[model samples]
Target chain A: MIPVEYMSVILMIVFGFVGMARKFPRELGATVAYTAMLFALAVFGERLGRIVYGLLYRGNPEAAPDLALVQWFVILAFIGAWVVMVYAGQTLSFAGKWPPNAVTGLVFDMLIGLFNGWIVVWTAWQYTHRLGYPQQALGWFVPPLSERASRWVALAPLELIPDGQEPWVLGGFLAFLVFLRVVR
Target chain B: MILSLQHELNKLAFAVLRPVLGGPNPAITPPTGASTGAGVGIDGQVVATAIPMLGADLSAATLVLVGLAAAIGFVRGVRREAITLMVAAAASLIVGWMWPAVASLVNRLWRMFHFAVIERGILAENPMAAWGEAQASAPLLPLGGDAAAWQIGFFVFGLLILGYGATRYVAAPPPKARGIRGFSVLLERVVGAMVGALTGILVSRFVLPRLVPNAQVALLGPGTSLYDRLAPYAPTTILGIVLLLILFGVTGIGGGKPRQKMYQ
Candidate 1:
């Protein structure tokens, strides 16, 4: 069986190549949606998680949400966003101008797709840790992460972004993206 | 001898530019009453260390380089600059992350080469001591100082390959593109310049220093260039710039003639 770390990395690579195959316009829509979702998670994921547990799980003050439930919740959320953006006829689209030409454009498409994949994997990391690594019990992740995976965790987006300004920085970037979109 | 000639050239360039970058201006005289930062003085810090041919701070040169980079970016426009952004970010990030692995790979190859050719082939009669003798005879160049040279070789080779690959994907902009108006054209240059400056900094300040240790000490070491402060936080900076570039893309910054479907 492949280690969880190796599996997730392969998944990311697959998403990148898939994006390359889809080309840029559809990929761009997917990217914007993914990044917007990441921004939402960064800002309100914790509060929303609590709201779900309280409203649906009897609000039992002492009992935490099930790890499987949380994992499924995060997974479903990303899948929902991907569907809405990539397939729902609302993706950011531009066939010709921006990527300049074909070979480089495909590379750019792959990179953006890779970025989205990273966001997905990174979100899983945050949710798992926020609820205390529920995957450890299910044999998805073992105690004492391998050294390479540990390095990967160390480079987690906000964790690596210094000065505790992750939310502000992320929000500002999203706003700018939206502004440019609106202007054009 | 070639290295010495290169050193002489560095000295000659420094001597010519010293009055401009290092020496005080002869144009304006300071009044006697002026404090003039007299205690530290202009030459005090430099003279103390006494390293000639490299005393210039490079702050002025950095600005000029940045300006040149901005001009290059302006010409490239938004699409090309955006593409270059990813390439630059990849180059810097890869250089930062892969050095140890590359160095290790080189070491293993060297060991295999030494065993196969040097030990068994050339000096088979006394193979045991031959490798040791070769290592000891010359401490530089082919003997073993190739470590630093190897690092440079890897850098140049990687850069050339990546650059050559990029050219296939990127081409010159057509002389005039239809349907592009004032704001879009202006925006292209503006964004292009911004992207260009960032890529320039990524290459020169972030990438080059890490690749070449000797240049790092001479140029970006503590108190060497103002860009040194940002170099240490390169990963974080690259992450931010990557996000920003994506944010800038996916919009109407690109306006041009229709594109043909590629690889058909």
Candidate 2:
């Protein structure tokens, strides 16, 4: 229900604390999953959005979904699915020679949590902005975004990655993560 | 490497801030010096396009950079980081609080020493001349050739390193025990890093604001650069980091304890 700008601003710190609590394993798992989701969305989100919108239109003849909004909602669903999977007993759990203690591991975890928070909060912003900052969505009342919130949104992290290069960038990042995992 | 990354980020921030602040876009020509709150540099060239944006960036970046110290500290060892943090905080607070007085004293001493060396030129020729030469080329740094800031930075850090060395060797000398050199040593290093980082943050928090202007602190509010947005997160993030150290230390997990000496 909070404004995306306000929520996104604080989310990273919240995630940092969450990282401290979750330690390494769960946090890394979530990070990997989120990064993968970002990659998948970058690669196929538009195509999938068009397809889904077309199908919904064909099936009901009056669905009338905004394609961008649908895609963002789809992204939200994907995020939700991955969120469940990550928390669902270490589906993408990382394992190996663990760190020396909880605190040391938690440092990395906190960083990872902050990283995830940046992505997740941005996705939330995407959906909310696409919807034109309404006071409600579905049956829930959401807080309205301020006039200046959109300007601040332009400064959020990860949005500056050049367009038409997201797949390659995210793909390379995924590859690097795998390389790091293999080596270390 | 880090500076370059920060530069790229700054460029991006500047692009957004340009329109927001009503500054001339670098891409196109403006109608001749449209008073965009820009400043002229040392070489009589236009320096920052918009000083407030840069100020905000600087404030945010400084805070983030200081927070990064905590990350380094955690990776090293909490205890070591703590000691380092204490030493650094002490040194920086001293330097920041007493800089005016210290600068005057130093100038007086240098004047007296310079006069003495000149008077005793036959005995103190090369050493004094060499020292003078070393002081001459005080190169420019990030905050627009603010050599005073650099001097303060170096002075505080030098004191902390010396303080840390004293604590390590004099206050708590390590016993020469083989095969026990493990995570404890590692923990010591990480703790050192954490302390160093926290100290940097402390300096940034307590001392940096005084050095910067109101415009810089304005970004610390909200609706600014990414760094600015996250600037306020320092307290919670630091709390999380410190609490993790304490919680994990108490739990005795992560092999925090050194491996028992098999050889001994």
Candidate 3:
């Protein structure tokens, strides 16, 4: 039987092609933007839910609902808030007479595409090795130069932070960059 | 050569930006005695070691690059695009953070199916027993339990939010021009092939060696000629190249302009 590890390597290549075929940078940017918006929504929704729940219960544990029920309520709140925020952001971003709209879209799209492509390759790398394939069965497929290139690619972000520091430091810096990019 | 460049860059950066960002410190290193195997460093507590100067240098270089890119975008009046790129970067960070939980959930679900099949006499006898043995051998999360349930719930919720948000906000913008521009088509093919080849090598060298160390897939095995070492990578590299070519062919081409109906 063809080894599963080999199959996974094939799958990774297919994913890479699909990513490029789909216009890697654009799709990648969109994925990242959407994911970030979703995360923001989730965080906002959870906070809102907590506030609402607190008001309803008035800090009384005895009056609180079951754990599952509370969890469900929180999830619902998260979804509701996320939907509202996404729509509002979209409308705001597109409605303006912004000259940079097209350019911004293109640049971001390209950046995301590159990032996503790397992610696809990285995840595939992890899987083929971790999933119990015989040594070198899948590893032999990757070229030497590519391996070095991937490491460098991976290191770009890793180099930004002091070792052992929270990743958010970099995230915050990037956010600042976005703000600068948008404000002008 | 790259390392030296990085070192010089870091020195310059630290001298200039230390007042604002902070003084340069050593980069974090893995605990000295920890094995480089799966589940070795998952726990939050990693014994600290002297940070690599190279890491610091790289960090400085990255900062400079980001600043340069932002400056160029500002000059080009692509403010919106720069903003979008920033947002995308932030979003990537969020996704990266959540990926582990999501992957763990998927693995558990797959294991459940595997277990069920084994129980049904598909693979072996005493499937649960075999599973227990496997679980003990691999340093993975539990297949199913309370923690698993919570993880599944979180994954489902996250997916739902992402799906809804994507449909509403992340729809692909309409293409402006039609048919593949010749230059762009060529560019795509060349870049795609290069990227594909690199990815093939990365998969085999860095990722596989770390995860499946026992597998005899070292890129530069002791005494092996470079040609022999690279022989196995040929198929994967070709596959990558071909896939990229197809991708470029299909997506690079655009529909013709309304006035010109020649290439329909």
Overall lDDT per candidate, in order of appearance: 0.56, 0.53, 0.38
Total clashes in model 1, counting residue pairs 3 or more apart in sequence or in different chains: 0
Greater lDDT among 2 and 3 belongs to 2
What DockQ would you assign to candidate 2?
A: 0.04
Residue-wise lDDT of candidate 1 within A89-144, one digit each (tens)? 65675444645555346656787778777766666665655556666666666666
In terms of lDDT, the best-performing candidate is 1
- Give the alpha carbon lDDT tens digit for every residue of B1-264 in model 2: 334544444456556544544532233323456555578898999877543342332445455656767665545345345445556656766565665665555665665565455445336667667556434523223333233444455555665566455545433332113233655555454544555665666656543443433324332445445645676565446445543443333233333332222111
Segments of candidate 3 deviating more than 4 angstroms: A1-49, A59-63, A67-184, B1-198, B201-264
DockQ of 1: 0.16
Clashes of each: 0, 17, 15
Q: How do all the candidates rank in terms of TM-score, highest first?
A: 1, 2, 3
List ranges where model 1 is wrong by over 4 Å.
A1-13, A39-99, A145-184, B1-170, B173-181, B190-264
TM-score of 2: 0.49
Looking at candidate 3 chain B, the ten consecutive residues that score lowest on lDDT are: B50-59
Tens digits of per-residue lDDT, candidate 2, A1-184, equal 5555666779768877876666555566566677787787777765765677787787676667555667656656776776666666444444443444333344455656776677667755654565554324453445555767766665433344466867776776667555544443
